[model samples]
Target chain A: MVFKGAEMVIESLRKEKVDTIFAYPGGAVIPIFDVLFDADDINVVLTRHEQAAVHAADAYARTTGKTGVCIVTSGPGATNTVTGLATANFDSVPLVCISGQVPRNMIGNDAFQEADTVGITRPVTKHNYIVTKRENLGKTLREAFHIASTGRPGPVVVDIPKDILYQPLEETYPEDVNLQGYTSPGKGHAGQLKRAVTAVNDAKKPLFFAGGGINVGDSSKIFRNIIEKTGIPVVTSLMGIGALETKNPLNLGMIGMHGTYAANLAVSECDLLFGIGVRFDDRVTMNLEKFAPLAKIIHLDIDPSAIARNVPVEIPIVGDAKIVLEELYPLLDKKDRPAWHKTIKEWKDEAICINAYEGFNAKEDDSSYLMPYQVISTVNRTFPDAIVTTEVGQNQMWTALFWNFKEPRTLITSGGLGTMGYGFPAAIGAAIACKDRRVVAIAGDGSFQMNLQELATAVKCRLPIVIVILNNGYLGMVRQWQQMFNGGRYSSTHLNDRIKADKEDKVSPDGSPDFVKLADAYGAEGCRVRSKSELEDALKKAAALTDVPIIIDCLIEPEANVWPMVSPGAGLDEMVFCIEKEEE
Target chain B: MNHVISLLVENNAGVLARISGLLSGRGYNVESFSSGPTLDPDITRITLVCRGDDTIIDQIKKQLNRLIEVIKVSDLTNKHTIDRQFALLKLLVQPGNRGEIIQLAEVFAAKVMDVGSDTMILELTGSEKKIEDLVQLLDGNIVEIARSGLVSIERGRKHAAVSQK
Candidate 1:
């Protein structure tokens, strides 16, 4: 039977078992949307902007372990997704973004909404295709999905011209893809694995350094088992959060610039660093020369290039993390490093004191301001099992540090790109992917406004996402950096309308838009929280709402900074602790 | 260090862009590049000459291998291989200098393809060093030069075939 290119797209998606697509429509994609209008099997989520659509799809892929899908029209619609694609590429999220293009004849003619979609997206995408013929639509789509979801998964784009979608075609979805050049490592080399086991056995202090690849490779459970069998302490990169339960005593918090003092010290002092599914990004390996200086690093990852890229490795095993861990588990011998544990315990205690936040005690101190830590902790407490997403900057750091993520895929954030305004839309995606799980997006005042338009999407879908805006009236992280390095020249970090207001004014007229009112305008519930008690009450109220999104604008400390920060280019051990350090 | 890399890639639209874009985007220096279809119509072979340290070259090869279009990546820098380049030179053939340029071209086995009233276009296919010598021998008389970058292959039965591994 002959079918139109649009039908082939839907059929291809159906064969892939894709149930939802986060998308935005425009001039170039009217025919596809026309077909989607009556399509009941596929749920089309119409986000306000193209960027949000891709971000939502990326988060959806993260939460469900499925290849997320999104469709955007040509030109600006396609370009807007660059940040989202780069975000997914860096974190290795599997996504298929379909972009509508001008007609084949008009593609390079500078016609209306014409774009070099494939060229623009080549670097950010794992691979991309421009379908000039209707006959190749189904096969190209199958290839897109296959490429996106396999072997260190990443985003891929398929650009179909507008005329191609209207033409008739004989369609057949290929059952299997055969890309000779694209092969993923499945098993570790026996020789290298043996050497790694030997290193693990010989070390007095061994550390497990985990990254997002563990989650993307679906090896977290095996990873935790490896840690359990070896009795080794672990520290994670930001994207590696939730790979090991925060409840695990041996699981040191995130290890990076804003990593826990204990985690950073452990990376610095370990005799052997066994990294699984991690590339050792510069953020994690600050001052690479001094990073893990004493460690004989053993690295295992699915991507061959990731090894020895940043830090040198004594043993490099290139393979899928799950398969590698399963093989290594039998070779491992349990160790009892009493002396190393004692040292780590002292560091953990020091970290706890440095990270201590005055949660729910501001009333006793006669302070009316809400702290960022307090707001994050309260939300974490209120929804203990909720899926948490965070916008970049201080909000992200606080959530990464304070949220007790006990399961994999529970904390979703733009770890690699650090894209601002990613959380709310990502929370929307997470909510849609897992309807039973409560989702919360912790955003900053500056970051929240970046994609606040997605509130309409959340409301339309009736997603029970609680967006907690820690409104600090300034670009908190940048302001903190300016305060530290730029001689207190706040510059353009201030977001408040009243520029002359004292920087200390906790409740002074906050910038425009009034978040609560903005939520109301979008038909979502909204409230303001000032003190610790108000935040708790507002969170409780938000938790009860199951059919609509709720915006909680928690007025946090204006000058609050994420502490224990390692200055850029400094060693991980050179952390700038908070003022509350225990009397030297 | 300078290295020559041979790659077998799927003959597809935008394959070249994906490769060159990745190299340039990563700040790897591409000194020279040439690509053409192999014996198989569906496959194209690209040879690129790049300059980098050992670590940088290692990463460049891995990154190239990561591209879906690339079928095989073979670094011929230290391998026993045969390398050749093709060039078309337009030389200024003034009445007096024509014989001197012709003598230099003949020594390099260059073919005198076309001779106009005042210029000579010579076609040469040989090793890069041979081409360099011919250009050096007639440095001032040459008006234009278009040289194909290096194309290299393993010397013996060892081939960058897809099924070899």
Candidate 2:
């Protein structure tokens, strides 16, 4: 059947099995919104900010493995999508951002609310298009979805000028699309498979460094098989968490800065490194020159540019992780390496000991604010396999360091873009996708405000997500930078007085809404915790609830900062550890 | 080892980025790449040259096939392919040697696209090896060469026809 562009978009999404969409309305995108209004099949959430809409969509994409779609208006509306687009792109989350542009005639004339959205989002998106004609909308939408979900999945944008969205066109969605310039590597190269096998056989201390690509490619089975057969110890990047069970004997835990001492130590001493579907981001390879210095690197990724982009590789394989691993599986020899496995096991034991935190002693009756680490560890213990999403800042680092993730896609956070306020919406989305699994959002007070409005969306959708807010009364990350670089001159970091004032009345007389009151207003449960016991009880109760989202406002110390953090513009090896002793 | 790969793909948004992301993500080094629309609006031709051992190239081919948009992938390095590259060289020519340089250009069938008092620009299109040989012949007199990445076609066959279902 022939359909309008807006109707076609909804229809296409329906075909893709999408049920909900998060979006904000605007002038240029009224047509699509109008269509959505009449449509009862797909639910469109009205977000407070355009950015939040896209972020929610990204969260949905990550959790569902289906392309998350967001619709926004022209100019400012489209520009607002940039942050979410960049976040999705960096994290390799599949998203389709449909933006409304000024009519084609007014595009370059600098008309009202006109912006070069295609140009602005070029670097941030996997691919983008400006639909000047209505006829191309169906093909473009179909193609956009395909591109977003394909190899090394990422965000794709389609900029539809207002006129095209409004245009009445007899358009038929192509059952199949053919593109000429794009070729995704599907199978493992036979030669590379042979060489990888040879390298594995020849190596004495071979290690597998895994990354997020493994999850995106659904290579967990293949990865487990390869490791099981080859007896290669595996360490994951922060994004790579959950690829293998952390409890697995062969799993060495996450490696890099803030990584387990065992993982870093093992990588440093290995003779051969087989990196799969993971970029050697600076976070993983602290010192490029010294990283795996003793190892002969065998890099396998679908992207060719990643080969030798950071750490030089002796052999590079450009292919999908799932396919490549499958091909290499049978080629491998089943040789037992008990000595090497034992060595890794010993290192893991030491790591567990080093990372252990001693509980608060009764003798030391210090009534200081709750430690971030204690809060994170307690939550991890309570929800051992829960999908944990984090807002960027000290809380994100705390979650990464404390939560031992044992499944891929279980720890969904904006790693590459480091976007704040991503936790609540992402958690909500994850809760929706994995209905059987519990999802928790660990966010700092400052970061939480960025998308606090999403609490309403969660409540509306009846998504049972537990939000643990590390309310440090300041923008923790920026405040820490100010403390370190700005001579301890706290400019705008103070939030304690304001937080208390807002709590008293729950909303300002000037109509500014308090978060706790807002959560209650939206029919969701809310609690404020001051002690460790209170926080733990709130989390346990929240986890038990499956009808509505819960918000726990945690009163934490503003001075607390994530330790072992590598300061920007500083050497990777140089890290600022948390202070254990008072300054002299 | 260097390998030449010819891929037929659907001309769609993000296809190029997907290809580039896949290559770069895997740690494979792309030596050169060129892509353009074919005679059909739905199809496009992409020729990429990458450096790695045989196993790596094989992996690249396998991965390229997995991409939904990709119709076919052939490792042209060992195959009979009509490989061509375009290079435009601007040269600093003295009045005395201008005739000699023109004679050399005629021998190679290179066209003089631009001429100036002290500079002459020659446009040449040929196989990579042929272009390299031509560059060596005029090495001392050449000022600079701007190359468009290599583009190739399978010899005596079209990729679309073979892959069409």
How would you class the docking of model 1?
high
lDDT of 2 by residue, B42-143 (tens): 877898999998667767886676565677787778777777899999999999999999999998889999999999999999988878988999999898
Q: How many steric clashes between backbone atoms does each model show?
A: 0, 38
Superposed by TM-score, candidate 1 places the C-alpha of residue A155 at a distance from the truth, in angstroms, of: 0.8
Q: Give lDDT tens digits, candidate 2, residues A1-584.
A: 76776777777788767788888888988888888887888878777788888887887777667888888888899898899999998888889988889888888999998998877887688778888678888988888888888877888888988877766677677667656546567876678678878988888888898888888778887898888887788988877877887778888767776666667777888888899888898877877766877888889988775677667788889899988888888888778777787888887676555444333111123355677877887778888878889998778878876777776778888887888878877887777677898888999877887888787778877888888888777788778878877877778776555445534735334432355676798898988776778777888788789889888887666587765555554433354554445578
lDDT for position A393 in model 2: 79
Tell me the TM-score of model 1: 0.97
Write the residue-wise lDDT of candidate 1 on B34-144 in tens digits: 999888899999999999998899999999989999999989999998889999999888888788778878888999999988999999999988999888877888889
TM-score of every prediction relative to native: 0.97, 0.77
Error of 2 at A205 (Å): 2.0
Best by DockQ: 1
- When just chain B is superposed on the true chain B, each candidate scores a TM-score of 0.95, 0.90
Q: Find the candidate with the highest lDDT and give its number.
A: 1
